[model samples]
Target: MADEENRKAVLARVHGKVQGVWYRGWTVDTASRLGLAGWVRNRGDGTVEALFAGPADAVDRMLEACRRGPSAAVSYTQLTL
Candidate 1:
């Protein structure tokens, strides 16, 4: 659909118990599954940082997924849209 092609982007910094919690790897997998194109990395200030660029819906889904995180990865995410 045309809507799926509409690109969107967001730079998110997820905080709280995110660092050293495999958050970056979880983000990468989640993003990939959502068909998003971006990268994730850990910040020195105890956060997980990522840039998600893709179809608008997919990007949105990725953000939501990041909030819940992947299984037992204690993360309280705070992202900026």
Candidate 2:
């Protein structure tokens, strides 16, 4: 178990060409590899919604990866909650 005091959690919505491009799959794989606890899904507005929970450093790395996603053509506008 992670130390809850050091754990970080974020809920984010990623926008721009994130649908139908294996974004969710990539996210699942990446987050799992990072040992994060989270869920990801697509929204009706063509955005991807995700929750990331783990070490702060890992979460930061995940957010950075999300900025580029799986393709160079992909763009992101992340809103965190």
Candidate 3:
């Protein structure tokens, strides 16, 4: 497959007690560990936002993890590209 086809970009918005719960830190660490290139930040609406670009499978794994989130987080909504 082509490099572009093997890569993907994901935008995730996590909700339900995600803020002030180390969500961003966990996301950053996970992304780094997965060799993803992107960033995670807090939104003004009490949500955590992240952009992840990496191998398709790795990105998908990360997205799955985001759905459950850390112990403190409750839920997540993701958009993939």
Candidate 4:
């Protein structure tokens, strides 16, 4: 198993047309496949918020994937924490 200290967790807010798309579902599937633990939810301000936690590399990969969500034109991703 990877070192627990090597893991990373982040809270991010995705911008653009992320709503109504399958971004959340895609995130869940992608994150799950990556063995990540987190949750994704839609914000009222036309954005999507998600928490990703897992191996550093896996989390990084998930962040990259969020840049271009499923069928969603992502403008940018903001890491809150």
Candidate lDDT scores, in order, read 0.82, 0.87, 0.86, 0.90
Please say which candidate is ahead in TM-score: 1 or 2.
2
TM-score of candidate 3 against the unseen true structure? 0.89
Best by lDDT: 4
Model 2: weakest 10-residue lDDT segment is 71-80
- My TM-score estimates for the predictions, one after another, are 0.84, 0.89, 0.89, 0.91
Expressed as tens digits, the lDDT of each residue in 1-81 for candidate 3 is 698899988887777788888888888888899999998889899988899898999999999999888888887675744
Off by over 4 Å in 2: none
Name the top TM-score candidate: 4
Q: Which ten residues in a row have the lowest lDDT in candidate 1?
A: 70-79
Model 2, 1-81: lDDT tens digits are 557777899998998889989999999999998999999999998899999999988998998888889873285857677
The positional error of residue 13 in candidate 3, measured at the CA in angstroms, is 1.3
Whole-model alpha-carbon lDDT for candidate 1: 0.82
- Clash count list over all predictions: 0, 0, 0, 0
> Which runs of model 1 end up more than 4 angstroms from their true locations?
1-5
lDDT of 4: 0.90
